[model samples]
Target: MRLSERLRGKRILITGVTGFVGEALLHRILADLPDTTVVALVRPKGSLSGRSRMEQVLNKKIFESSRNAAGGTTELLEQRIDVVEGDLSTIPGLPTGMDIVIHCAGDVSFDPPIDEAFRTNVLGTQQLLEKIEASSPDTHYVHVSTAYVSGRRRGAIPEGPVDHVVDWRTEAKWGQAMRDRVEETSRSPGILSKLRKEAEREHRRAGPITAAQDAERRRNEWVQKKLVEAGGERARSLGWTDVYTFTKAMGERVVEEFAQRMSVTVARPSIIESALETPHPGWIEGFKMADPLILAYGRGELPEFPASPDAIMDVVPVDHVVNAILAAAAESPEKGKPAYYHMASGARNPFTYAKVYEYIREYFDENPFDMSERGAVRLATWRFPGGERVERILAMSERAHKIAEYVVTHAPRGERIRKIAREVDQLQRRLEFLRRYMDLYRPYVEAELLFTDDRLMELYHRLEEADKEDFPFDTGIVDWRHYMVEVHCPNVTESMRKYDVIRRRRGRSAPTVAKELPESGEILAAFDMDGTLLSSNVIETYLWLRMPELDRTERVREIGTMLRKVPGFIRAERRDRGAFLRSVYRRYAGADLEELENIVDSVLAKHVLERVSAAALRQVRAHRAAGHRTVLITGAIRPLTRPLEPLFDEIVAAELATDDRGRCTGYLSGPPLVGESRAAWLIRYAGQHGFDLTKSYAYADSHSDLPMLEAVGRPVAVSPDVHLWRRARKGRWPVEEWKTSSAANRLAIPFADELPAERTS
Candidate 1:
């Protein structure tokens, strides 16, 4: 029977229906063979319902052809397909009346944990075959495998069963053992913390902590590191590149053993990429085999890869693989007969690594990605360094990474400084992930194997004259240059751009500050926390009394640090109060952020809020009543002003730098809000929110606040310092003594007659 005719009315069951290959096959079958009923096996993903999963697959671009053909509606297409929510590894049997079973599901992670790969690939296949034999023994089973099942072999890899020496069952048992070992090593967070505390206590008994002690204190991290290393080592020792392919080889053996009693056609396709032609050209899903490297290089990120310039990469389009699978299923051999067909183009039409690199460079040169800051990225053919050299480069990069981490942790905090540090950290992370990906793929990209697809070609030639037009698997017809330049690269670049735009929108800030600002008639009141609204600075109080004295020496040292500031303060009284106050807070660099916040909460509840000036409180209440957006500007740390947060709409203050793990990193995130910095922040905030700065009000007592006071229309000097009193008089700003309510109604400082009439407080 002809391939297309054979598919009519056939009840076909396909696993991995949501995957790239499965998605393409569903479209092709629906569009070409309208009479067939496709029973798809879909596993429920996290939070996504089974129906939703099926809808998502059908919603992809590959299904557009089928949807358009079905009268611009998916109603008919949905009626023709049946979806079963089940797992082959644990589920009992296939849905009833299935004449063909196409198993396309398998773990594809390059470094998946050993047990998971075996469970999904080897054990799952065994269970599926047994269930199929019992339920539908005559079903034509099409087993989708990979061309890399040939392992570390060179020269020409033929279409046949893999000669793996290890028993499949033994390998599966080893997988279970590894999983058990990993589970045994895993410990709860509570247990880990308890052990860490004990380790710390033990280290305290010694003079100074050693590297071994530190490692012991971080037991969870050490165990995780060991497990990751063990997985790769275990796979290599078993003669497979990774746990993925190792388990896949074992799965092929499962099919081999089952074919002894039933018909099974194993189709091993080489690195399946986007569609070249069929439903649509340049159609692909998320970053596949070669895409990550290509994109990274285009962005001037990847410097080198582990592959020879002359190595032949066997790549086949998704449409060709889908065609071969359907054809094989229709013309499968008799029961108890098994066959192997390699789906590859390397043995026929080959593209060397050098040619791929040249094409990439040429394409990018013609049309480069528009990275505003980096300009247009130019491609340089990557160097194929030996394994040892790659390791050496990675070690050097690690050392540089360590130095960067230290610098970011120790640098002074400021908005720009913090931003640069975060960028550095993110770049390092990207480089590390790229390194792992390249290392895992090194064997395949650098392999010297040529895969022959004689069986696939023979089947293609046997198709009927009209069938050949619909199903073309001949690799010789593919134009490598045209596909790379006109189809594949453009698709990749467009996809990347779309993803970046979506990402930016998802992460974008809601509105600009200028847009949020009020009009000229609207009110905006800015207040200073330390010595303006509050009687004293909260941070100094914490340093003096709230700190725990570990010992007499520590207590004396803390006291001396405070005392040493007295001379500087005395000089700053005649010089710069901003410099003195900034110096005082620098001592808080090494304090634990969470612990400091807790201390602030306790101190606020105990005594800080009680010190708020009554007169200043009344004035703040009056401003709020007039519908003002109150802003609190302070040189102190953010946590110290938590008690007053409800009284203000916005707070601008100094920030503390924290590590990726959210621990204090002994540095400030940004500069303290003092002197002209406070004025600049207010101006920027007003511009962002569209506020009229000329109508805003500011209240402060220090001479360092002169710039901020001058920027606002209504500047008030509350209990003005000597220098500020003189400036308030010179600028004709109001001066008020915010004395206790019991003493008087409001006391105005005797400002020079040139000043604005002193306001009552």
Candidate 2:
């Protein structure tokens, strides 16, 4: 009988219809076995019901041909397929009288949390098998599993049950409890203290609120890392490669125990790639195992193939795997005994890592990836080093990149430093990705296992000649060079091209400002004073004020003193912005408060107003015209900021403490309006004045203003420094360059004479 003819009039239950392989299988059935009725078991996504989610799934491009073949998507869903609302986590009762069940769902992450792996792969499968035995005892079960269940063993693996002595029930229990244990250890005092220190170092300039959030984030990351490490250790101890395969093996044991009562067939496929012929050649949904490595090598990020040259790269096309699965489902084994099949290419027509590298190199050389201004990416000759040595090299490169990043980040701000910082950032991101890739894929690339697919081929030969022509599962006929270059390479590159365009669009599409400003008094517009609105910084303003009060020798001595302390100021600024401001203000010690006010009045016109950014002034005026409350929130001393008072409705500037004689005490009267304190103050002020923070706007340039910027709905980065620019880019916030006023524009400052008149009064 024809494969589709046997499947005709049968009722099938399929799981993981949303996943890549499951979706492809569903499409194949809908297109070929049009008479079969399918019940898809799906879990409700966030806001979508099961039926709605299935509708969305059918709308995917993979189902285009199937949809058209079945009259249309609506007709296919309404007349043929039924959506069952349930998940494997809690196995709802199976539909009655299922002729066949295709179990395709499991946690596919290579190193998921141990508990998740067990919950989805081991316990989930156990529940399904139990339910099947209870509700639909006569159903033929086809479980889709990976070929790598052979684990760390390196030899010719046969198509049969895995030999094991460990109790699967006990292993599942241990794996499920691993996360709780790791999380408890992560909460220990020593670990928390270490995480706290790291967080403070990274986010101190942003604020205490941000630092606390960072600490919590790091704690979660630590717990996750420990869980992954524990899972890997447990798997390796049990002779498995990862949590995925370990749990999968446990699932097979569950099936083995259930096989005494039910008919079962296990189909194991190795490294499924893009389609070769079925459903149109080269069709793919996402990048799979070898695609990342190939793309990385083509981009010149990976200079070496981290694998033995002679190791078999056992990859089979997805269409072949799908066909083999249908064939397995069609041939039901005798009750109380299960059949095993390996849908792989290694044992039939072996392809080595060396050949894969050569084919990919040839493809990329003919069709190179263009990198805009840098020209086309050139592929380098890759050395086939073993995984361990390559990992060690990557580790060394990461350490060196970290050192370079630290130096460049701390260096003085200039055009050259910015350029170097960008390069360092790119290298850091690339290194991080490469490290993660190596960690996840090292075992697979270095493995020496070759799966024998004799049983699978025998099943194919049993099919009638017409069935064989219509549904082919033989991997021996695939030309490795043609599949790698003509099919897989183009598919992966096209997917990557689409992703790159979407990523670039996301980075460039952040809205800079609202098209129409709402006229409301409850809306606030906050501006950082120095480096944001004006080109002058604290040091320059301090020099202009204090320099004229001293003799030539005293001026030289004061200048030398400030220059010597600049390095310390820079370090403090990076660690804590408030501390830096405090240290800088200490230079005002013993100077008369009245004298400083006088000096500011004299220098306020040429030294300060001339450096004001005309573009920033226009923004402030626009905010005022929109009936919004305008405020200047700065770390600069109050006396020096008095001249800019006319431009703001309120000024939250720092104040110096004075003694009975009215001389400066070189200390702030209260905490400086910087870092987290500024953010806290803004929140309190908003509460008191009934201002809506979600409608408020903030503009700043320094990293210290991150807290304030994040507090508002609209945050603009104005002439930002290296750290602030990077943060803005990460957050997709608008960045603007605010230039200093020209000589002609300086005379047009709003209420320029009002400050001197007020001081004289």
Candidate 3:
């Protein structure tokens, strides 16, 4: 489609420039078209906040692909791309004299209120129109709209403006969803409340589940909760599922109202999925509910889902949406009637829901992660009398009620299937227990929503037609089938890799992380809790090292080991009825803080010799020699106290609680010092005594420490984790990598038997 002509030297402005779809459009425009200038209008923010999400979007190919589907990459387009802060609701002043203005900004809500849809979509368009009119520039405006404007049309809805009467059928179908949302909201005070309730209730049922399950359970406990959450019912009725589109319908109407006098074109695409064509294929990001659901189902996350295998699910790639939008805008006549572009088709290319499932399943087979299979006997779900799959699913639902019936009547790790049953039942019970006592965010996943993707074909074909030379569109060069399987799949995995930690950052100020700690009448040299001294991961600690002799097994595990104990650890839990736990509870009920400290000190002084990083310790003593007060301001607990004590003047381990007698009774008396809390304490200690945190230096390995890291005058992250690493890169924090055990570190090790000479932290 001759995209070369329209894109030549065009200056375009885009709203929602940082949004999922907007980013795609921006990327496409930037990468494909030469001499094109794209200006982005983003919602503003304060300083010291998360770096522009645009960076995250731009950096990742998955994000880039998604953005490409809507548009091309601004960075690659070789055009001057300017990001201007603004929102759709209010049109902030834009740079004057733009050749093409794509108002891709609108309230993209799933179930927006009629008034809000009018205000943000319609009124927002009105505001943009007014702004453009006032400027009186030779700008061709392209408004991104949705294909759902059919408003509940039963048959295949065509593209273009039609005076189709909006009757009771449309209103009734859409109205049901709103009513359901209202009903759901009425049940719970808030969204979190509902999720928590569902989680709590699900926590009681028998099944292997994640946090989402518990949340679903809590929400489902109330029958009406599902019905009230907007698009569930209405989505299915319209042959296009999900609430997002329903709200978008209102947006389309708004565009129609405001596009009359403007040089506008409306691009209506349905269920804009990942990129079909662009720099890459199937490049998707954002771990939406879909991924979790799929992963869970694959890992037996849910007992069953109510869905029709035969239901048609059509999705257009992001680039097609972008292609149609760009070409239509380029083809727009002066003062056009909002050039309507339907971005759906089945004319020649037919991608079915069943085929999609097959493709996804095959992709999983080839690009498998370290997903563990059910380890034992298969979980035996309810056996339905009817042979049909639907009947079986329904039967399982009924049986799920009695999920906990066997918990009181089973052995640990029974049969594999039984184990699953036990696990789900136990998890649900634990969830219930926690919900009854702990402060938790409740999440409710509404059920009973029928979602569809009927007009997807019509939209795609229209977009394909727009791609023809008459209108002209080019989605760069992307392979759809392979892209989805290989490209997008890996992108999702990588983003979620190591819990979504892109990279770790090392900050400046290595010397600030002191070896010698501060004590009374001593120069303090403190090491950061996470990175400089100990490894960044605590979970890895327990996993790699043997649990303390006492903490060998859950039965005998010490409440507080080397690390300072949290308040909750000290409190006796009554969830278990086992005598073994009860006996331990009695032992922990009355513990002396001083005695506990002594126990931890002995372990730190002897057993846990491997915990200290020798090179870091050597650096500590050098500070002491240099007359700096060496202090160990760590998040470590008593027993897990490190090996480099003598180098420091005093060790400020995480604070612990004490009994009246001060013997090691086992429970913590107070809060543990860690992260920001630890920072706060350090600030107070320095202010009251004679320390200057700002002038002093700090070291760590986690990005979560960004707040505390900044508080210190010098922030250094050695061997940083992903978050910290990213910050270090962005904030330009200096990083140093060194071995923990060095020959010069001999003087730093307080104990004779330190971590093996060759061992490194």
Candidate 4:
């Protein structure tokens, strides 16, 4: 009999109907076997009602063709699918008289807390088994499990029951104990008091409490850390990579407990990806195991991957896995003896890491993801330098990331630049997370996990020719090269394209010129002072200059204050640079404004002017000669720009607020003109002074000046950063390199702070 013919008249209880596998199976069953009853268990998401959440799933594109063929209406779908509003963990029992129970839902997170993983994977499976025994004792149970339950083993993985070291009941008791401890410790007055006392002592030593909410946060953080450590250590001891797998193994053991009472089939699929043939090829939902890495590579964000070139990575098409699952469910195994099928491709059709790398290169080379207005990015050539090399690279990357973070934290504050720095920090942190993920999946990806699929192949052969066409489970028929290049790659790129994440990375073609330059010549020429005219940052130079004057006691106190702020400073910059810049400038409070101006003038004469970029200086002179209104725009305080103030017709920069005594109050009188803020300021200033912005010229060297560059008709980049360089190329903007290292070296200024050696500009 055909697969669909056999499925006809069956009442199936399907869990995880919103998941990739469950959704695909539902579509298959409803489209192929119209007579079958599909009862889907959908958990209410957040504030969404259960039926509302089910409607959301039904609206997915994967269900489009199925829905269209089956009456093509929501009412028809409502009639066909019985949506149950429930969770597997808490559900008392499923609907009675169900012919088949397909348990597809479980926690798939790699690092879920031990108790959470067990509660969802093990306890949930146990609950389902009991429900089946209570409501429908004769119903067949089809449990979808991952092949990685083999857990860090080598050679050919067998198609049979898994024999784990820990008893399922013992594991369950341990999980309960952990939960009890967590709840007990949370309410314990002694523990909470100790944590609060320690936090209070640390706060007293640090500084004045800036916010009350922060006071209780550290104590909670410390307590949570201890809980996580305890769970993580226990997970590791179970010989599994994470709590997810260990609990999944326990889940299988729970299934074994009911093997004698009913017919049970465990379908283990290895690294299931997008569908190959069924329900439309290359159809995938959400980011799966390797999708992030693939997307990152397409965007040129991923530079290196950690894996051995020749490692056999077992991957299976979603359709083929689903086919195996359905076929396994149909099989009549001997009573009290459950059937096991390994739904994988490695044993019959294998794709090595090297082959995958080659396929990706060829795919991108032929059909590069069109970032549209954003200039195209080339995917890096993946290098698989073995395990040791990967660790070495990670160590180097970590050190470099730390150094970059340090520079961003201490660098002179420019709101725009600070915002960009924060983005850089976030990207670096993501890279770090990816590196850790790579470590977690390294053994799985790099190992020779040759799964034997003899029983799966047998089931395929037994299917009639018509059934074979509709439900194909044979991986031997898949063309590895074609599937990787033409099928999988395009699917991933298409999905990411819809996401719009690829184009948002600093590349967009310049907008068309809207208005011509004013012919009568009321042109504004905006010059970015710090990196444009002045080779060094004035604020940083001033800080170094002032460092030597502090006494030992004052120096020690200041050092402690700065050290205590390092973590918050980095995080603040990442979250919001404007706020970070404001916080940074606030440190100058109580210093005499006039004294700082005098110091700025002396510094400009002795150190700043000579280091001014010769190329920039010439351009400024030319603008002045042309009768254009010259403006010096910098994030530095007004006093720091005083020495160079005479050269410009008007100065636009951050101003320090002064107290009644004329000392710095360390607050800005207005918004600091940095990054996009600079552009806003320029537009306002131009409107007030009757200067035509369309006729104006702007100069800057960083990506933060993107707004200013886009604001004016003629924008120039001088020794620009990487992001700006890419933007400039795409926008056809002028770029000039300036050299001022020798001029900077000519100064004999003494500095007390042991600053990192400066990079020559």
How many pairs collide in each candidate, listed in order?
15, 0, 102, 0
lDDT of 4 by residue, 567-599 (tens): 897666444445766887888788877766655
Rank candidates, TM-score, best first.
Answer: 2, 1, 4, 3
- Per residue, candidate 1 scores C-alpha lDDT tens digits across 480-593 of 888888888888789887776675564354221122334333667899877788666533554533354134577567767767777666565334444555566666655667
Q: Give the root-mean-square deviation of each candidate in angstroms.
A: 14.2, 3.8, 13.9, 11.3
- On TM-score, the leading prediction is 2
lDDT, model 2, position 390: 81
Model 1 is weakest, by summed lDDT over 10 consecutive residues, at: 745-754
Model 1 RMSD in angstroms? 14.2
Q: Against the hidden reference, what TM-scores do the models get?
A: 0.69, 0.93, 0.50, 0.66
Q: Which 10 consecutive positions of candidate 3 have the poorest summed lDDT?
A: 439-448
Model 4 ranges with Cα > 4 A deviation: 69-73, 176-233, 369-375, 415-423, 500-761
Clashes of 4: 0
- Ranking the candidates on lDDT from highest down gives 2, 4, 1, 3
Report the C-alpha lDDT of model 2 over 1-761, residue by residue, as the tens digit.
98889999999999998887888888888878888989999999899988888988898877787777767878779988988898999778878899999999999899998888889998999899888888889999999999998899888899999988878899888887888788888889999999999888878888877888989999999888888888889999999989889989889988888887889999899999889987779877777888888888777788776888888889999888888899999989998889999999988798998899999999999888766566888787878867778888888988999899788767766556767887889898788778878888888888888898888888999999997887888989999999999988988898676776776676557547665678998999999998898877787777766766676688779889988988887788878888888888888899899878876776555567778888888899899999999999998898888788789999999899999999999999999988877788899999999999999999998888888998998889987878877888788788788888566343232222334555435
Cα displacement (angstroms), candidate 4, residue 639, comes to 18
Worst 10 residues of 2 by lDDT: 746-755
